[model samples]
Target chain A: MRYAFFPGCSLETTAWDFDRSVRAVCRTLGITLEDIPDWVCCGSTPAHTSNASLAVALPVMTLQKAKHMGCPVMTACASCYSRLRTANHKVCSDPDERQRAERVTGKPYDGSVEVRHVVDVLVNDFGLDNIRARVKRSLSGVRVASYYGCLLTRPPEIVAFDNPEHPSCMDDLFKAAGAEAVEWPYRTECCGAGLSMTEPDAVNRLGHKLVSMARQAGADCIAVACPLCQLNLDLRQADAAKAYGAVLPTPVLYVTQLLGLALGLSVGELGFNALTVSADSVLQRCEMVVSAGRGGRP
Target chain B: MENRLESTGTSFLDEVQRRSGTPISACFQCHKCSTGCPIGPEMDVLSSQIMRLIHLGEEKEVLESQGIWMCASCEACSTRCPMGIDIAGVMDTLRMMAVERKVAPPDARAKHFAHSFLQSVRHHGRVYEMGMLVAYKFRSRDFFTDMDKGPKMLMKKKLAFLPIRSGAASEVKEVFKRVEEEKEQ
Candidate 1:
């Protein structure tokens, strides 16, 4: 399968590991991704909060470019996916908004190009059975908490992704990779997103709640699909523990990173060491379980 | 944390309904939005209370309160609201209106952050994280915030030293210009 990939701004810098692991995993699955030419920023929260017209126009410009690729556009960042989908939804449903967007973007957009999140592409398009077939190593003993965080599933009408309140796509993907997917309640909770800069205190508190919930559910590591979610839950985890009292440190891994481990990709290939919270302990435990000859799930 | 009410007419409600395109009248004080809001504790007013303030025409309270800015736009409230009020979209509308009217938002730094982020996008056609953070520090005049995280981020190679300039930057700038011109009209 081939797709036009829009890796948003975050993937270029802070979430570079996610971008790397996404590419590595897709390659293992025989999926080819071509970068959309001159794909600009999606105007995430900053643009949408400030100027509605600019927000729509920014993503529409990228969509117009992706149309030339003659395939569906895939985004790894949840915020970018949301922005792209929102723009398409508005331009297609409202003629007045479509006119304004065309005037601002200087391109005629019929919203024909399809936008899909990487997680959706994996579970639905590629099929979990095919993913299971490609696994070279089994993560039998590792328990993963699937963190959806918001934008991936919420505002269901626009995103139309998974279940808004309780999503299972990430968990299903992990299960297919032979890891035990733990049930967690805070999967769809807000991670204080853009407020990570403005209101650090609030974000710390929210992150603490999420980590504590994940620990309570007995997850060895938290798997995320969004860059902001991973940053807050992993990078800010220590500070959150200090703020809300001590909880066992739970490492945060991108969904693709965990899948890469099961697919026999090297740590360097998946950028595992780039994480603030170390995944070494959990990975070692998995190795022990495999060496003990209990690697296969029943 | 409020001043005297300027007007209690339907003007504020009408404006919010028109701008957000939500059915404000359908919100029957359910408080479901408030129950689902993760950042409700940090907000000066709850989500349902913000809707009530708009209905009562308390524009000053709704706009100036930190509630609008505190909204993460998670859409939890919008999804769970039985009346389908689009609470998150209304919060977005209120935030933009607050900026346009020059209201002293309870969280001024939030507004500054948005401006700094947009400036980076306007210049580079994408967000240069370091550049945007620097611009935000200059605008907010609080440089020491998150300073310690920088060294670690740089060590991890998470912080890029320079931004790769996008070739379509000029075209992106033109789009921003057209949007501004349309707003002026």
Candidate 2:
């Protein structure tokens, strides 16, 4: 299967690992991700509060571009997926909004292209059996907390791909990849996005609580779909530890990265080195860490 | 009590409504938010009390309250509110207002961190951790708090001394510009 990929802005920088792993996983699954050229930022947090029109227009342009490319658009970032899907839903459901969006993009968007989160494509399109068949090494000993964050599930009508309250998409993806999915509260807690900068204490305290909850649930690592969440949970963890005088070294991984590893992709290909916490110890425990680093491009 | 009341011009209710957009008057004093708050035990005041202060137009008290700083913006109040008020948004608005007024909590470290985060985002169109940490340490003069932590982070290869700028950084700048204009208006 082939689809246009939207990596969004954060993936290119802080979450480069996600970008690399997603492409590697897609190649392993025989899927081609034709990146939409010159794709802009998805306007994740800022757009929602700044102006509704800008938010809709930003993603509408991408969708229009995907339609122009004649392929369905797939997004790995949950915030990007949510924003694009929200824009897509608004355009499809509201005619006046759609017309306004078309005017902004200078192209009539008939809502022809489908905006899909990577989890939806993996679970619904690729199917669990197919993913299971490709897993060379099972993550049997690895206990993971599948954190779905707010954007992927909330405002359900716009991104109605999974259960808003208790999403199973990540759980199912981890299971298919041969990892144990742990149950934890705060799976949907806010990682305090840009607010982390304006309010680090609050973000640190909250982040610490979320990480602690996941660890308390016996998770060796936390898997997420949003780059912001990964940054807060994994990168800011040391600061969080100091606030509470605790040590939390739990690694955070994008769902695709874990899937790529389970599919036997090399660590370098998945950009493991870019992660804030090294996955070698955890992956080694499961005997799934690849010895060689043959950088493969999708 | 009269002197205290006269000292603050606006009441908490009016200040809260003005800042939070949550109708303090709509609250029936139900403690659902307080009851459901995961961090309630850690807070100086219950969420319900904060809502009540807003309704009462006790603006000075609400704005100066430690509760504003303690709020995690977890949306637990919003989730549990039968009144459908966005308690978290109210907290966020109050926090923003606090920052604007320079009435942030007395923690210099926290204040420096907040400033560092905004500077990083404003400059790079995204958060740059290394840049933010360096800025925070330099600004706050708390150089050694995390001095030992950095080497450990580096050992784990988690510390990237460089900031990676986004490819579509200009677009991000435009978004920020638009947001600033809206805020000004």
In model 2 chain A, the worst 10-residue window by lDDT is: A289-298
Best by DockQ, which number? 1
Model 1: lDDT of residue B66: 76
| Per-residue lDDT over A38-131 for candidate 2, one digit per residue giving the tens place of the 0 to 100 score | 5766655544433445667777766766787887899998778877887888788879778867765556887768888888899999999999
Question: lDDT winner among the candidates?
Answer: 1
Residue-level lDDT tens digits of model 2 in B44-107: 7677897777665565666666676655444547755778777766775666666666776655
The lDDT values for all models are: 0.88, 0.72
DockQ of each: 0.80, 0.14
Cα miss at A297, model 1 (Å)? 33
Question: What clash count goes with each model?
Answer: 0, 9
Give the Å error, residue B154, model 1. Answer: 0.9
Instruction: Return the top candidate by TM-score.
Output: 1
